[model samples]
Target: MGSPLVSRGFQEFGSALQERRLRLLLAGRSGTGKSATGNSILQRKHFLSRLAATAVTRACATGSCRWASGDVEVLDTPDLFSPEVAQADPGFEERGRCYLLSAPGPHAVLLVTQLGRFTAQDLRAWRGVKALFGAGIAARTIVVFTRREDLAGGSLQQYVRDTDNRALRELVAECGGRCCAFDNRAADGEREAQVRELMGLVEELVRDQGGAPYTNDVYRLAQTLGGLSREERLRRVAERLAAHRELWPLAGFPSWAWPPCWALCCCCAFSAGTCPRR
Candidate 1:
């Protein structure tokens, strides 16, 4: 309505209004470009994604940056579904760290994987997410395909529809028809477009859910406890947390707020909601 600078500033401000702060949890098996996807979303190389003999992400890594539209927090996790990570060691500490990093919750859970790279491990990974977060998470999830340049001339929607991989296709369908492709190697101009498109998808998801993030029973219970007296609530939370004896004395957790903190951590790990860092 005013000068060019003023108009441009207003546009950016409106975009931010359409989408404010978002917490994105990246999940997939190793080598699925989870970190790379996070880097692309941040428009920088914050998370490492180089090829390695073993898994590169041993812990849950977090990266946050302000985009033209709004702020985004990316939580990149290791292969939580792998037999080694799931059964043998389970990395409760790593999972707990990721949950704690997310804080209150996460908005959308991005199940990242390379285009045409869905395998048995990926399927297991999906199951693992369901196990931890509950069946309702599928609705709040988005299947993100990385390495889009290798898709030839085909579109991501077409690939999702035409792919012969039943499991992968079903996975996409389960997420309320939400999916996107990211060309992390694209030029600067193209990369920006891709990120913006992805943001649009995220905004649509948030809108569809009535602008509320996803949460499970554990998280809801923790929230309910917040209304109680501090001493009583902490006592109840501590009693409930006892069920997860293996996760007791959460690594790096404050000793004073162990009960509620653990409850929040568990809720964070298993919910698809935005964890407000601020």
Candidate 2:
């Protein structure tokens, strides 16, 4: 018989592969090892990775790599929550682009950060996600931590277990305690092993959420119908979507402004996981 580790890997990979198409959205700050995390998952340099003071990915970009089951796509983005961008975008203009790229909605939204470096910016990013996607989207989030090597033979779960950082604990708790870690620098098969663990978590999330992807209408309801019951919110969400479809024909953008806005948006490369691999 196969070892437990091998069996677990198979299960994890299977869970992700079961989906007709798996869409993973990676969102986080630029220097948080965000891009590298995607590269590690693909086990290739699919997204650009570097150190910079400002945001590197200014648009929403998606790259797909083949897994045994089929193609897995990862969407990377800039700081969609940045104060400058938020004032003008206000969840409508920019969000439409994200919705377009991820389509129906992403199956898993991976919030990336560095281990031991969850900063104020990180917290803001999390808040931005909830504000932008609405609080209900929290169920689909998985906190991915990069730079696993920094643990120095320690595990992030162990650190969380022992640390008194109240904010960090609450952050993880809000994510339903789902976490994944990636070394990013690992050159061996260890990378594959790490990704399998992540897929396993994705599978668990799907089961818990009854296999429903976070949809565009759900995103709309999240932003518009807060403080209402789920049933009412969903009903209103349907109405709003129906209205948009009916009115979309009459709505036209100013020729000059539309191009750049659409182009810039097409361009937030908008862009983790939890603890290190064992």
Candidate 3:
């Protein structure tokens, strides 16, 4: 047997050999488990997970972890296309500051949804992603459906093909038939397997795009924002994402209720261990 220190060193060296950093933006409706998806990808409970009537994410939450041979950063945000956000807070770009949080930009934006629960709101979310990122991003996007346990003996592709929902079918087609299923409640081994499968698709996508992520005029705009001082850029991103709370009247909360809410959200991001890694 080798010395314990040498063994640890070898393990880290092995990780380095397969170390590829991937930034992924997980987008979807409020209850669709965007944060849970990020946790699943990172293989840890880094983001808050709870049952809430409104958006629990509040703002963009970023988390990262080493998965197999790759390092993945997942940016989870409040629902951009939520009719509530679009109608109430017009300033909240459906994409919000997710791109900005992703900085250099993401390798892929995984559109998350609950299995068999694709609703009108989800369609709006997809439209929001297209509106902000452009249709070209559809090619780089992957539809990730959570709650695989609900599939009932069928694969995700089969469900997509056999489902009666035209909107869901169309959305899947738009993503170039790229889709994945994850059970956030699964055991560790199973969850990691799912992450590896999704990463495999990501690798293929990276190759097809010649190692570039999807980008558009909005991405270019975000790149410009990057030139600002780090603190100022982060401040700007927070302000942009803060717009999501302006119209939470449906929650019966007063407009003045937002400042405290924003503060609490910021606290959650850091306290929940989802803050951006340096």
Candidate 4:
């Protein structure tokens, strides 16, 4: 049998060969780092940001991130809680309703938030997010906790377990227990792991939709590596390779040693029949 990584790579390659675009919506309240995460994912400053509590994103902003697998369009949305924007249009709520229906519908809506102090306002904002997007949207949602380094030695799992934050718990349950953390300032192995987990969840959601998995990991890997300088990407890959070798002595030399190593690994594995076709 071929390696699972190689198989996944091939499946993603085949999907990319089809030239399908995956669209995703990034949603959350103001100050949740939704814009920051989108910028990080797209590896560019596509979304606007401000220090004010109620700065207006105004409308949905779109950006694309290209990878070995395919291109993904990420929509950075305005704060759903913007009263002025909501009040300005008589049909605002209906417009919000039509937003999802107008598109192929997002592959996923990443609900983002910063680490520490899950407030009552946060819960209320989450409820509003669900209301506007629809309750069933949870099936396609992923809770992305940002600023992981600020957690003060607390894991996301631990934070969830310890908190009485009912809204957060419900949000996680809605997303089928899918949660990932990222530290926007750090572009290291830990950040890559979080992105991989997010991609894995996206794959599962796509499978559940009776569609082919996008293998977001391949795309995400390419995006991350693409954002780095050539030397930085090589250095990071070497570091990861060394870590993998230390952890798994039976593992062989990595065949895909270039910048898009993850994508290459998935492609080779899929071609060799190690990855699940479904």
Locate the minimum summed-lDDT window of 10 residues in model 1: 1-10
Q: What are the RMSDs of all candidates, in order? A: 12.7, 12.7, 12.0, 21.4
Q: Write the per-residue lDDT of candidate 1 for residues 87-194, one digit (tens) a residue.
A: 533435455444455545678899987786665557667766775556787877888888888777688888778765666778888888888898888998878777
Q: lDDT per residue, candidate 3, 1-278, as tens digits?
A: 11121233333533543235667888877798888888887777889988887778777788877544446678888766554554644654434456677766678889998886676557667766665556687888989998888877687888789776666888889888999999998998788678767876776676677666566654565677856876666556545455434334332334463333222221133423453321
lDDT of 4 by residue, 1-278 (tens): 11122237435643843336666778776787878788767665778865665655766678886644566778887765332333433334333322432253577778887665444445555655554544566777788988778676668787766655555676677678878887776665555555656667766676676553222322234345656675555455444333322222121223242223222221234433453422
TM-score, cand. 3 = 0.73
Between candidates 3 and 4, the lDDT winner: 3
Reference-based lDDT, residue 98, model 1 = 48
State each model's CA lDDT, in order: 0.67, 0.66, 0.68, 0.58
Question: Which of candidates 1 and 2 reaches a greater TM-score?
Answer: 1
List, in order, the clash count of every candidate structure: 7, 31, 0, 9
Off by over 4 Å in 3: 1-20, 67-70, 87-96, 225-227, 230-278
User: 224, model 2: CA deviation in Å?
Assistant: 18
Q: Order the candidates by lDDT, highest first — what do you get?
A: 3, 1, 2, 4
TM-score of each model, in listed order? 0.73, 0.71, 0.73, 0.64
